[model samples]
Target chain A: MSTATFYDQVRTAVTNRVPVALATVVRGTSLGAKVLILPDEVQGRIGDDALTGQITLDARSLLRDERSETRPYELNGEPIEIFIESFPPPPLLVIFGAVHVAQPLSRLGKQLGFRVVVTDARSPLATAERFPDADEIIVAWPDDALTQIDIAPTTFIAILTHDPKFDEPALSGALTTEARYIGAVGSRKTNEDRRERLRAAGVDEAHLERLHAPIGLNIGGETPEEMAISILAEMIAVRHGRPGGQLSNAEGSIRGQVTSPVG
Target chain B: MNEWLPEIDQWRARGDQVALATVVKVEGSAPRPVGARMAVSSSGELAGSVSGGCVETDVFTAAQEVLASNEPKLLRYGITDEMAWDVGLACGGTIEVFVEPLSEPPGEKDRAR
Candidate 1:
């Protein structure tokens, strides 16, 4: 693509949360040289080897944050500059149940910037008509769906499936990888049953503890939508390492409490 | 730079002189980190921000001077407790801003018509 078009597309990509990088020659030879790169390949370039090499490294680093800038490098005795921007798409929310709670929970997940994916064995309950907000409505079995794809830290799991047959396998699929948050929508009795099933399947107790059974914060929310709000709030709190308790009830620094610090 | 482009282009398209003030350095708990920017138009209009409303007005003033002088300048705005309340840094941090006037805004002359 032309430089301008590539620049425009890269800009849109960042705005849309699509990962992208731009390479510019900030110093040395071809000081004003430039290029653009996505995850797959180069869309544009700075016209030299050293400059492209320097920018490619910078691009790899930009995948983590909302914005970042790197130091300048020289290309063949010439200064080169490049900026790789990440407009990474929102993380995926994989909900493995078509229960009553999943309806509003999935809707709330979308508002919280998650790309909602609802999957279940039952078709009638998890149809497009019932969930207009869900980006994907998969009628496949949760285990089957999960094994078919990789779940990165950016992916979140909500096992509202409740039934052990669906629930245990989903937990196995999730615990097998590094999905950021794993929560289950169920009652105390339901959670106890889940723990037993998980133990029977050889998932250790410590791993079982990672399950946020009786999912969501103790906000005393009873309704499905309110429950959804609390659940997502808890997920966000876990993701940011924030205290799940109310700030008013807490003491000491709102930051650096309990959790270690990292940028 | 890309975030401020819309306002920058609007001002530049109007043949309005502009000054770009960017925070290149900050010490301690600054309201704005390094690279935070603000664009000031000759009409005294502003686009974007460089602080938590702590020193933007002064930065805008510096930006005006950069526009008038047609030269790039670096300025220090010390805001820490070391500086009294009169210095505008009640938040107790300092920010150094670089103001540059853009006479040849990329792809300007051709678009001016």
Candidate 2:
């Protein structure tokens, strides 16, 4: 395929929020050649059929891991190197309240490369002017909005609607999804009462365990921006499977365990 | 790379040759992540970056050469005491950047997607 067509496929996959990988023969006789690999199909050609097949498999593996790396291979006794670059769609951050904290939280989410969506029932509160950083504004009930959007493992849901009428259904809807992180904002007693209400409403204990009520790391943050940072901290910790504790008290690598070659 | 789409399209629209430099592999504490990209135009204009202020000048020169030669080049940059005054990442990390010329875009209509 022509390079323009190859790039078009890559761009289309990325715009559609699909995981895609591009393998380039960076240090080979076929240098500048590329192959585009999606989950179900492959396009372009890095080299001959055998080499292209190998790169396609490797590209799929790297795409699944959301990693980019350079790997060395041998073609007819000659060393060849290929760079496999994976492009996973940006993670989704859904904020279910356009409150004071949501403003800074959405901004932080965008700064961190998340696609932020803010949803609220009150049209006046969920205006685009209030959330300049949010990629989407849904003026609908929090639970209804949650059900309407696509929530996958790459999604993080924050229920800031503290009222029972909203937070209850919001929590229920969030728990039903495969979202990686589901956090809610409330006081300790408020969370406890919220849990009781959820339990009475048939939300099982297993699902209740998934709720991060009284959300955010205990950073002693009182202002809206600081609270936003604390919430994002907790979300990041959850993303990396960390305990969200003080690094000074923690052992092992400050970056956590280096499990992959890319690190 | 998606972040540089508009700039790349503009360069192509202006009939300027474009070379894309991407950090394919990173070792140790690099400033940018693996997929970080920088685009250089034939007129010497640049957008995005593959490193901190440590090595863009060299990458720019290499990009111009790649654009002229129509060949892909893989470059490595790192810090060493011997090369302290040279172009190297001050963060003491190694990064492999691949520079290659991008073909002219299909057309403005195709770019809207």
Candidate 3:
């Protein structure tokens, strides 16, 4: 396929938030050849038939885990190198309360390249004026708003409504999705009470274990902006599977794995 | 690459030959991850980056060669203990960049048709 056609496909997939992979030949006979891999079909070619087949399989595996890496192969005793780059959709951060904290959190989420969605039943609170940077504002109840969103493994859910009427339903609805981080802003006592209510409402223990109650790291944040920082820090920590500790106290390298949210 | 697409498309539309450099592989603690891209126009205009300002100068020079010859090349940069004290990669990591000229400029496409 032509390079223009390949790039057009890439731009379309990225604009539509579709997961795709691109494999480029960095070494061997067909230098600079590219193959575009979509969910249902693969396009283009990387010169050699055997090398293309092997690279396509590897690209599919990398796309499944949202990873990009280079691999070396031997085609008829000749060294060949290919780079498989996976382009997963931007992660989603759904805030289920348009409170003071949600405002700053939504901005921070947008800065971090997340598709921020701020939802609240109160129409006045969930306005575009409040969350100017949010990609979406859903003025609906927590259950209805959560049901409409396509929550994937890269999604992060934050239940910021302190009231039980709002928090319980949001938590229940969020637990049913595949969100990676489900943080609820509340005190220890409030989290315990919410957990009891969730259990009574038939939320299983496995799902309950996904909650990051008393959200945010122990950073002693007091103001709403500070709390937003701490909460975003915790969300990043959870996404990287870190303990949210100081780098000075860490044992290994400061940089985590190259591929984030490794499955 | 996604972020640089607009600039690349504009460069092609302006009748400038373009070269693209991508970080295909990295080791240890490189500044950028794999798949990072840098686009260089024939007029010396540059967009995006593949490293933390350490290896970009060399990559830019290589991009010029790719643009001239229309031959793609793979370049490797590694930080050794001796070179680390000098002006080489101080990040103590290695990165492999692939540089290639774009297929055709917009003017060329219309002329060929």
Candidate 4:
């Protein structure tokens, strides 16, 4: 889209769930211009075909992950004097339960700028009225809801369908996808029990470890919101490769912004 | 830039001439990312940010020159291993920034046609 309406339309499209891409001149002679691109056409310009063609190709790759960045290139179709910065909104968070904890977890996730989707098999529990703050609340099985959308590495998946029958297929589907985080809510005994079931179901040990089964840092959380905080904390820890344990149990300096929430 | 549309539009509706600067790259632990950007108007109004804060002053200075000369320039800052340490990031990050003056198209003064 042209620079004029690019922000308005993109903001509305993103807040309304329409996929889009943004290409901007991040460097070179034409440093401050931009265009918005959907799957079909464009809303802005970067001179002409040679530069636009190259940037369109790059925009396609970033489109899948909905990423934003500064990418440099040449200008006048021959000299290097242009940069295309792409913005594709933010990725999504698909949670497979509307349990007591899902409320705060989804709330906190929204605060961090994630488009949260809370799903459940029970209609009463999955109503939008219950999750007034979530981006979407679907009253459907996890697999059915997930089948309708493509998953990205920026996506986060949670299996709070405490029951084994629901959590199994739910966990199975999430593990097979490219989501950056896959966590399940449970306990030590519950973790061992689930591991046995997943192993029996042909899941390998390596893949199974990827599942954060007790699903949170050891914060001794005793309530839904507290547990949500611990789970979010552990998710943060995993994203940055920090040890997910009590401060007394960890080592080395903690690094980077505490609120990045990126995986 | 489209990135500043929300702020730029608000400023433009009030008759502003905006200048822009973008951080194209970082050689070390720079606070801002490669695509970071900031915009300024002829009347000293500003929006967005390239560095979290440390390098914006330098960018503003460069933007003033771009506005005066109407010429884009690639300026480099933050050299490590220098005891003089002028205009360098304390975090020891090196950065490259491009500053330019944004102008209206021909026959499009009143409206950005």
What DockQ, on C-alphas, does every prediction get? 0.11, 0.44, 0.42, 0.17
Q: Residue-wise lDDT of candidate 2 within B1-113, one digit each (tens)?
A: 23434688788778787899988888887777778899999899999898876889999999999989878899999888888889998767799899988865457435644
lDDT (tens digit, per residue) of candidate 3 on A8-55: 788789778888899988889777788998888888877568777888
List the candidate 3 regions with Cα displacement exceeding 4 Å.
Answer: A75-77, A200-202, A222-225, A258-263, B1-17, B81-87, B103-113
lDDT of 4 by residue, A125-217 (tens): 887777887987877777787786568876778788889878888887788788878989887899799889888999887788778877888
Question: Which residue pairs does candidate 2 place in steric collision?
Answer: none
Q: Give stretches of model 4 more than 4 Å off.
A: A6-37, A42-48, A58-73, A76-79, A122-130, A141-154, A161-166, A176-178, A199-209, A217-230, A233-263, B1-22, B36-49, B57-76, B79-87, B97-113
Point out the worst 10-residue segment of candidate 4 chain B by lDDT.
B1-10
How big is the positional error of residue A164 in model 3, measured in Å on the Cα after superposition?
Answer: 2.1
iRMSD computed for candidate 3: 4.4
Model 1 clash count equals: 17
By TM-score, the candidates rank as 2, 3, 4, 1
Over the stretch A1-263, how does candidate 2's per-residue lDDT look in tens digits? 65556677888887678888888888878887788888888888755789889998888887776777889987777898888888888889999988989999999988877889999998899999999999999999876797789998989988898788888888987897899999999999999999999999999999999998799999988999999999999888887777888878975444422353333
Q: Note the Cα lDDT for every prediction shown.
A: 0.70, 0.84, 0.84, 0.71
Tens-digit lDDT track of model 1 for B12-81: 6688877777665555456665557788998999987777787888888888998898766666776545
| Residue lDDT tens for model 1, A1-263 | 33335545765775565676655433345433446667777655566676566677667676555344535565556544333444455777888888888889888887777888898889898899888999888888877889765588778888888687888788887886788899987889988877887889899877887888898899998888888888888888887667598878875434322442211
Candidate 1's TM-score: 0.63
Q: Looking at model 3 chain A, which ten-residue stretch has the lowest summed lDDT?
A: A254-263
Per-residue lDDT of model 3, residues B1-113, tens digit only: 13444689888778787888988887777887777899999899988888888889889999999988989999988877766654456677788999988766455577745
DockQ of prediction 2: 0.44
